[model samples]
Target: MPLCHLLQFVTSVVSCSPAELKLDNNGKKEKVKGFNVILKDTILFPEGGGQPDDHGTIEDLPVVRVLRQGAEAVHFISSALEEGREVQLKVDWERRFDHMQQHSGQHLITALADKMFGYKTTSWELGRQRSSIELDTASVKPGEMEALEDAVNNRIRDHVPVNVRLLSIDDPDVEKVRSRGLPDDHAGPIRIIDIEGIDTNMCCGTHVSNLSHLQVIKILGTEKGKKNKTNLIFIAGNRVLKYAEKSYNTEKLLTSLLKTGPDEHVDAVDKLQKTVKRLQKSNLTILRDMAVLIAQNFKSQPARGDFFSLHNKDGDNEFMNIIANEIGFQDTIIFLTVGEEKGAGLFLLAGPENVITELGPRVVELLQGKGAGKNGRFQGKANSLAKRAEVEALLQKHSCRRAAGEE
Candidate 1:
């Protein structure tokens, strides 16, 4: 009746030749001769649908890359063997096996979500280490997601047979086949992968012969998407084992650093944080007591008219500021202190406002420092205690000049 139906009828009536071709390592057309066998007509689908291409060896030589030329898939060989000679094809059994596990796992996950939540998978991808299927729904609740993950994993453990069948698009059986999506230009016979009792889809990619091949399915996480969609990220098979091993190693390292076992490391961190806070409080209390003692000692000093000096190893900028403020109210007190550590010194000059303005520059010049301000108050650092008397003498001379109105 319809053109598609007529074409399907004709295709069903005739079997198309298998397109697998086995070539020699030298890229020559050949038959089964060496361990490497390139197929003339192959069911192996080169990487598409975000899933990588299959990797294997033909006649023992590795197939490094599989590419598409028009409608044909080409398997590139590694070693250059005899040209124009036929070789036996060998697919990398491990890689092919893993791909099958992940692909089948993806179908189970998508199908379960569609059946339970009405979330149809819009697109899907099989990554190297992980896979994801995007659903038409925007979001799924965490509890609902947990149920979906459990359902899919249960299916993997069910060990259903994964069947691959080629049928014409126009066949009457096509009406009974429900597919997520099929390649639009796949006009002749279509490759359908049926996960018995789970899913049926048009796919050219290799899959495990049975569901038992996928030992496990682990949903790692789900992320939100635009246009009312969600991306389901997951790992399966040997990938799950590898991920668990890595996590175990990381936990071991952390436990060693924390000096605690795996189960206690988190509690150890919390306890250590509280201990640090308590010690910090005790240290602050000691600093405050020291500040008060220093302030009192400065007050007991005899008020001097010319200048006075003190060297303090425990004094810092804040400590010096407190002491200076306490002693500054005196009529004439030029307090100086050498800080305990390197790169520290303090000078506090206070006298008649006019006298300080005149002598401050002279004092700063002698100490090899530079600063200026109003009033008979000047504060700064000296290079060393040896230069303190020299700076004090300069200040005294300037004060005398200001008193004599010669400044």
Candidate 2:
């Protein structure tokens, strides 16, 4: 198919066609029959300039990824497109303009940082909801971010006209640009983002042609970055409204839960947490006292050196431990197991080491469980306590055999 590149503004909606279509995974060359389209010429911006690509549609089919391959843009689609077919390329204007605001806002910020604070923006990234710039300085002082934002936002409110122009590498205005020279792989004409009187810089990302298009510039926060650099995280355009809405909703929820205004929510939460700790301590003491009372109730059950205690306590291992400790000190064997219908826990402590060594495995086997121990103290988990009564009888039966030494 014959192909030609479109000469259109960054915001233009393009009419194009598939110059050639084939299955092109990022690296895999398998013949997948879907998920990519290659347009002859498109207004959709590819991934570049610390900014991401635009996602829209080609002939109403969703275009998921727009990648820059040399001078051409490769469009990845959800469905395969036929060669030379008419396709209308549309840019998601809302998202596209969001990128424009952030990308252009970055240029203004980087320019002013160098102008006012001598801090340079070395690199940046455009993210789904947030964007950040890595500064050349070792660290940004706590107080400097406010001043940086103030200056950047002042420029945005001024509504400075922006210009995009193609220049030859030999043009004298090249020296007036910020940062280093053109990229090593510079192709065609050099594109410069000229921000009125604020700054001029080289960038491949699509940006708003006017500064006021960036509704606002807000400094979200900052952090220490790689190699002693500082990163300033920020949002622009409609995201400023979005970030504020989300923050307000969160604050509203916190205030409601704490039964206080936003100003006192933290103190309210602190008091609530302290009160919970006190209640937890009180409950633990009550459970221990209850366990002791339960031991007294079962202390008189008679057997031939055989003791069995079963309780369905929802796998409270600590309660099981307390019961075993209270009654297991006597001169007899004990299988104090607690559990529910699905599973159970066993804590075995016996007066005779040989008796437990022999009987513990059988009890575990009866319940289809797993456990191990020596010196007549064993602990394990079991699949079922349904046979607890049978298992209890087995313990009593084993005690009789062990006492008689009938092996």
Give me the candidate number with maximum lDDT.
2
Off-target runs (Cα >4 Å) in candidate 2 are 1-33, 180-186, 277-407
Candidate 2 local Cα displacement, residue 162, angstroms = 1.5
| Count of clashes, each model | 32, 1
lDDT for model 1: 0.66
In model 1, the runs with Cα more than 4 Å from the true position are 1-39, 78-83, 184-188, 266-407
Pairs of colliding residues, candidate 2: 36-77
- What TM-score fits each model? 0.55, 0.68
> Model 2, residue 237: what's the lDDT?
88
lDDT of 1 by residue, 318-399 (tens): 5555655655634444545555333436655656676677667776666566656565567776554456667656756764
